[model samples]
Target: MWAVRRASHPLRSQGYRLGAFRAASTKSSFGHDVDCGVVVTCVPGRKVHVLDCHSLPLLSAARHGKSVNGGYCLWNRGLSSQAGTESSGEESELDDGFSELENPIADTNLEAKAGEGEIGEGLVSDSELLSDDDNEDDAGENELHLSDAESEESKKKTLSEFLKVIVAAPRMKMDAALDKWIEEGNPLGRYEIHSAMLNLRKRRWFGKALELSEYSESHKLLDFVERDYASRLDLIAKVKGLQKAERYVEKIPESFRGEIIYRTLLANCVVQMNMKKAEEVFNKMRDMDLQMTAFSCNQLLLLYKRLDKKKIADVLLFMEKENLKPTLFTYKLLIDTKGQSNDISGMEQLFETMKAEGMKPDIQVQSKLAKYYIHGGLNEKAEAVLKELEGDNLKVNRGACRALLPLYADLGKADEAEKVWKVCESDPRLAECVAAIEAWGKLGKIKKAEGVFEKMIESWKKGVSSRHYTSLLKVYANHKLLAKGKDLAKRMVDSGCRIGPWTWDALVKLYVDAGEVEKADSILQKAAQQGQTKPLFSSYMTIMDQYAKRGDVHNAEKIFLRLRQSGYVGRIRQYQSLLQAYVSAKAPAYGFRDRMKADNVFPNKAVAAQLAQVDAFRKSALSDLLD
Candidate 1:
């Protein structure tokens, strides 16, 4: 009966046929009862199959063969080859069956474990099947699903496509989309999208990308965009592309508006001289109840200086109403603009008002005030500012001293100018005193100028620099003191100062003026040996003209030939001057008279016309002798 039931069981029908039956006393090493039916399949060769006997009553009956002629026959002759043919499929089926059974068992075990917690009963735990380390290994297996090369290539392709989009798209559209993408959590979109937007801003797209990025919290996008915005705004303003910047500013929502954006828009409008638009923006800022910074107000004042004074007065009145104290920059703009317009009385009143507000005039304001006084013919007032500045602990700036020195010199107040020069000379930072010395030279106060130059040289030797020496050399050259200029030039070279083309030209001209051709020649030769070809034609002409002027026709001709040999093509006047020198320096009887006659034969008009006039008079007197 058990054999018959086993043969008819589902396991046998699926080819896991049983061949024998055992009682419950039989057991296997894995702790399952061996009292299951053993299902056997007979083909050319014999194979055995086992099943749990308790779950297969029908297979048990088939194996026992109570309804068949065989004794405990559990074998099927055709089943063996079929089982072999379907081994894989049947194995999978068996695996699914085992897994299905095990899953319930596992759930029961879990429930039992949970029940153990409630009832304090001991149960086998999942820790027996696997350790935490094995769990980690399973995680590692999951991660291995994607290889490194595949992941990396996918990332690169994504980034490349993103960059292509950014590079090809219009800047405004790209920026807008970038803002939207960043807001949507910066997902699998290319990192280069943000980077490309940043690059566009760097290429001087100014506020476009930055305005989009401002409201984003992505640190990377904000950082790159702000850095690019700051870099390009100045250049954008310089090109008068402030409208593009204004377009960016207009996109900034009220909640995201800040001092930087406001300042940028205000500056752009000012630079474009779109004062009406600037005022509208400024008024919008005020209506927004944003605290206006001192810089913003100053920018408005600058725009007003160019646009409408009434608007400036209106802004000032608004400041008063807002209880905002006018800053130093506010006063500076008003003072400077008023001074430029020659509004002396108005500037005086404004200056007094600034002082009353406890804001002392800064150096810039004082400089403008000095200029105002000087221009209005109030030299005494300008001098008073200088004297007052001198007594104050505040360092009198070089610009202020420069303005004062010329005024004193122009007023013929040499004593005061000399005093100012003394103060400037003693101060190391006020090396612009050389400018005053040069001015004194221009005013033809050569002795005072020489005195200042001597002081400058002494100061320079003690601790000053080639800058001072260069300035003094220029001053000496301006005064036409060729000997002093040449001496200073040597001092500059000996001091290890680089003899730049300007310095070398000045020295060469000085030497040429002093008829020191040999010294100039030595300098040029040294420069050539050093492979420094500068002051090219100017230096050549200096020597040529000097010799021609001194009537040294021999040296002048030598210089002219050397210039031509040296590839100088520009000095036709020098050549003509040298020719005239040749005519002038000849012997009165033979060389001078014959040279005069030969001058007419050379048909070059510039030379021929000049020589023909000279020869005409000479020949008229000497026609009798020649005939």
Candidate 2:
């Protein structure tokens, strides 16, 4: 093990916005001087493997560079992108598979008060962040500016005392506690204040993080750097809406308003899938002559890949014009996009090109290729990839076990999945156990899945997180094992599992899949009432689609309306689900076309087909004549 050493290097010396509290003499709220020592977490070659998503390193680029996917990326389907946090045990696994890192906020006293729902509701309101009228320059007092260099908060508190102060009351704004901490003779260590904000963000507590940031800025706490500015910008975009973030951006001193700041904004737009805004930001970056990096290009690619695969070629053409060499991530996006379109030949060609360019396919890429091949009915190719992924020794290459299990199960190779599971069954990691449960669930082995979960509970050193529980919850959801799902959910509650959007999404799937759509809808409503965070967009989609499929137009319409009210107004899934509900119910959806146009959403072929089928259940004059 590498021994911890002193990083006595000054914060400003290292170019970080280390704040005014960086002095070693800072006292804690307890009135004791603390060691403002860095943990020296500069471990080389360390990789944070994401266990799951309501978790990117998060599906943060959501299917694309969706929001914070901010941890070190594991091989995502396309390419691994940059993320900085490790996964906490408490995350609920989202459907999208990406690699995440372990939670890095170790042994810190960043505790959350029970039932207060410290994190903000997930994916709230991406609705037009800035309207045509809320012009950029007009944002008034909400603007972000640099803090005063000698802010008093920085003078009073120690790092240890500061963490306790902020986390002591997670539900309320941190401003008062900070004031109280200062009043108590605590010297704010720049390290403590910054670490507190970083930990809160990792915990997915965007509102609290924003509150802390606001406090830091309003009190003139630290001399802000460009990265510090970018971090705050991300927090604002997440908490206050993108428009507010943009408005705040207008006040940023022009010197610091470089590509990183614009790129941060660009990412938020992509997360919300605001293609128009994303493009505008990109164009602005171009106009400013800011240097373009793989990140911005990847962001555009992710957006177009999801919204209009047709526009992907245009993004590629632009990249080519700029002479941008594709990174592994860029290739990952292109290959996945191609595979998704069922252009297997194109996908293969791109894979070859990546090889020709000397970018080796890592495990994640090979895993992704297996997925495409399996989906494409190229079982032989998939098997080859899986075998290659496993390599010679199962123990040495146990990391591939998680990826291999699901892919094998998807191929219906129960024995092969068992073979992979056997390798790790003796001493499995949390991720491996979760994967085994999913693989077994897919293979229809409920007992085996349960058995593994039981074993995981007994063996997992950190205790089974709600994230760990989420894997089995998904299995139960997939098999429509309502009773089992309910039992496990109760077990989770009894075990005091921290519920977030991920768990909420799983519960919705459980109820909806088991023919308990109303119950699922009820859970969602109740969750909305309790959690500071909104439910996932997919959660809304779950209920809406089920309602539509059941021909429950009233409920479907209500959910569709609720979805819009919840700030997920931009997604086409709800619109389609609502239209499909009308069609299924044999009801004419009058003026639906106008509604679509109003929202800037147009009908795709599937939605149009649905519309044609439901457009006139009543005989219109033209249709009557044709008949």
Candidate 3:
């Protein structure tokens, strides 16, 4: 659409300037200078024309057909040029007509006719201009004003060419081509390349494009296409290309750098394993004088976690120096990382800091702190954290409940553990609590752990299968309740829960712990018959330890030989147990003596000396009994 702005004129009627000009005669009956109002035609097709209507004497003389004035042509020469048909004959005819004019009215009519002819000629020229076919030779010469359809077609052509370049170029070359197009000073080219880059990003080639942009920045070519630099950084981050994303951001003009870009790039770098790059970018950001937001500061905290504790301290010092306040996410990350590293002091300090900052710990943070306390064997602190979060209603997590319940059982805090379990019972995540309860029961919190099992059964409603029953059996075996563990195993099998090697191993370990060798042997036989004795290292160690504890030299020797034959490397403790058993029997054979004397053999020197005392005592007892 063409926009027309009207120009204002002061001397004209209704603020409208007439398109015509007039010239006035200066002297009476003599050639003199004329006062002329010159009107220059501003529109492209028309020409300047002057009218001398105000010269009264000349007007009077021109009223008659004869020219009483000197050298005056009635018709405007400018009109002939406007009509596109300038000729000497037309000028002569105008002069003859001026001689024939009867009055000024005839001259006005003639001027009006010339004006109409000029407009008609302009219309004809425009039609011819539009009709001319485009050719290579005429293309530069013709300044044809584009119609809306033609402009749209040009835009489409530009966009199509740009898309072809983008699609044909490798990902690494796309940004270079885009930057080159933008540098060529074509707005359409800039828009097209920008659009193509956006599409490439959508197709999951954002990383490659980001790399190209970085290369462009290094070459000082990125300045041409920095309009959407922030958005490109965000896109690179969303696609998880942190390094390239950071490079794209570093190339962004200083005026364009803002909190959003800084935070996104910092967060991206925070999770990467490359600490050196992250630190460098972070420091560079600081040097840029950009105020780090809370999110960005938190990202630094996460980045510091992968470094040493001293480095973390340095980061904290830096944060303090920069006046960056730690947010809830920051504290949460610090607490979780410290907890994972078993840094109880560090976790406690972080918790205290949060309290000082008046930031109430959320459930996720509380869960982490509780887990840390539990790991340190500080059940009281763990329970306190849980209870604080749960409050009067005791709304602890099922997993936390399971974890804490076991700790309570170990500490004999059965009531507290039971309360936590009740809260867990109402939660839909009951199955998740099963492992926790079993863990607690195994840690000698049998009764408290049993409470969780009973809740699971009640929640399930129907008779529980062996799959469910085995967890409780495992708890029993863990607490050295061999008899109960075996009975539960049998019940589990009868209830159609297939007993695996783990179940048998648990039972055998429990029996071995209880010194029920005969029962353990029977269970082993049954396990072998069922093909459930998988000869696990721990189970073998348990049986061998049981033989050593009972002072059964012959059986211990037999088991040791069996273990070696079965590819078991007999540990020193097992060998010591054999020595004790032989000394207790008072019948140490030559082979057994030599094996015991072998240095660096099963039992070391210290254990061998202990075994010699046992042998001496056995000999004295035998002599006493004989006397």
Could you give me the TM-score of model 3 versus the true structure?
0.34
Instruction: Put down candidate 2 lDDT per residue, 1-627, tens digits, no spaces.
Output: 000011122211222211101112111122221111101121133211111111101111111111111111111121111011111111221222322201111212333311131211111111112123321221222354424443324322345566677778656557778888878866553444555664675566778877876777778766665655776788888777889999989989989899878888887887766666887798788777888776677777666544434334334434433546667766776666545544455567667767767889887778878887887889999899899999999779888998999999999999999999999998888889999999999889999999999999999746688989989998989888888888999999888878878889999999988888889999999998884778877788788878888899999988888777776654455677788789889988999988977775555545667788887655677988999
Candidates' C-alpha lDDT: 0.47, 0.62, 0.47
TM-score, model 1 to reference:
0.36
- Candidate 3: tens digits of C-alpha lDDT, residues 1-627: 000001122111112111011212112212322111122232333322221212211111111111111111111111211111221122210121112110111112222332232211010111111111211121322377666678667766776776676667675566666567668864432334344444454344555545544544555533432234554565565454666676777677777776545654554454332344555566556666677555554554444333222123233333433445666665665565446545566467656666767888766677667766866778888778767765654452344454455445545565766666667556534544565566566456677567767777677746455546767776776677776777777766676665655566667767876778768767665665564234443455567567766777777787667655543332344455566566566555445445533421323344546556655334566788998
Output the lDDT of residue 557, model 2.
Answer: 88
Q: What is the lDDT of residue 437 in candidate 3?
A: 65
TM-score against truth, every candidate: 0.36, 0.72, 0.34
For residue 109, what is the lDDT in candidate 3? 25
**Candidate 2 — number of clashing residue pairs?**
38
lDDT of 1 by residue, 482-579 (tens): 87787777777787776755566556666656667878866765664564433454565667666766777777777766655553322224445566
Model 1 misplaced stretches (Cα beyond 4 Å): 1-240, 247-255, 287-289, 392-400, 426-627
Which candidate number has the best TM-score?
A: 2
Top-scoring candidate (lDDT): 2
Candidate 3 lDDT (Cα, 0 to 1): 0.47
